[model samples]
Target: MSNDKIKEDLPAILERYRDRIEATIKPYLSLNLTPDENLTWWQSKFAGREKSPGGFPYLPKGFDYPQTSDGEYLLLLAQINFAEVPYLEGFPTRGILQFYIADNDSYGFSNYYCELNYPQSNWRVIYFPEPDLNAENLITDFDFLPEKYWFETTELEITKCSAIRWTKKYAPICLEDDSAYKLLLPQIGEAVPFELEDLYEEFTDAYLKILDNDGWFCPLQMGGYSCYFSDDPRVGFSEEEDPFDTLLLKISLIESGSLFFYIQSSALAKCDFSKVLYAMA
Candidate 1:
């Protein structure tokens, strides 16, 4: 078929197969970035660098829950888990677990990685190696670009896939006491100089990479805890306030791809740190 014909027909085909498509895609999808062909291409850009920021081997800081001398929570890392399960014969097996820390003032480091054949019925557990940890290393800036298309294969079929692109900004966080540590910036890639519409296009393209590549069927989950001072007046009613609180956010996405249904579980802070903080829980 002509490229134009395929383009014109795709919308109708997608509409007609919407239900089936959803069933095929839902089980493998997750938030953040989907590593499709474009992601591979983007990664390739940094592949030849002798000092490339290690991508897969490094773990985000706070993942181990570092504590201060007084035993107080100092930093935390967000955890992301991804997996692929094939019910059909001949399909390739794949999975990953990654961690992230949005830029924060109190934290000093960050890291991410994946697990192969995670959550299997058996006892085997393989932890993927990560890049080296640099105390001065931070995600200085990031750009979530439009999706890119690529080709992939399952045991039963060969297909095209889409993926999202992101560029992160990193920098060193300097404290008042002159103790400095690296920090990931707070802004999303959407705030970059690109046009808003272009940004959305990039995001959609990247997201489609996950779907087209059958990314949605994998079982994936992400979560983390954060502590900071809250100014809620109710906390200071009787005496000098403690001036700090904790917040926790957890999310999980599970999909089967063939059935296209997914469950997203998200939990936010339910109480103050003085009561039932996540660090202690």
Candidate 2:
């Protein structure tokens, strides 16, 4: 199909979800953002954001973050005891986002990753990674741009216009309704799983490469406490044939980072998560 044809078709899927999402998914969907629900407020309890004095949507001095994304709660996350994979409450997997949201602050749209906790009354925001917007970065800002299209943006007007266009076209998928919403995941990459030792090795490599310049290249992050199948290393399952039979290594992550771990593949499969997440009771 033509690029224009592809773009045109994408919106219809988005439209269907918006029309019926609120009505069908009564429990998870929210039209308004609340302190109890939105991460901008909840995240304040943990590590605070670094804020500037006056800027787009300005806030007071010493203020860690901008005002709440009150009207912009994008998704509510929760996981079954054993939702899709057996690597419960580990890296890459948080919970399930009821949908998506493109909410951001002056820097850019901040996508919040939340998990449903006990009492089930509120969501625990694991972390939120803000956009790192530098002129150099925008050159590859494909998230906002439509596929099959690209152009240089040395001019400010051309740049602003592109961001506006990308947001409009790309951010609508999160508001999708039930049936059509099922298709959104497959469009993402496949989930690829890895072992803890392997992950640590990769992390060490990245940490060293960027240590001088202060960088971490490893993209995988783990949550929850680590577990082992047995005391013996030989009996443990790191790359077992069965996805469920493997022992889990829980690693704490820098909550501020945007790293993401995946299942066997980062690609989204039908009715399954790409990130193998494990949660505890």
Best by TM-score: 2
Worst 10 residues of 2 by lDDT: 161-170
Error of 1 at 94 (Å): 26
Count steric clashes of candidate 1: 48
Q: What is the C-alpha RMSD of each candidate to the true structure, in Å?
A: 21.9, 20.9
Give lDDT tens digits, candidate 1, residues 1-281: 12112222334323443333333211121223332323221121111111112222123443333233343322112222222222211211222222222122312112211111112211111222243235344332222211212111122121222222222111111111011111111122324445455644554353344223212122221111111122221232224232121111222212111111111121112111112111110
Q: What are the runs in model 2 whose C-alpha is more than 4 Å off?
A: 1-236, 242-262, 279-281
lDDT of 2 by residue, 87-139 (tens): 32232333222212122321112322322122221212222223222333322
Stretches of model 1 off by over 4 angstroms after superposition: 1-52, 56-264, 268-281
Q: Against the true structure, what is each candidate's TM-score?
A: 0.17, 0.18
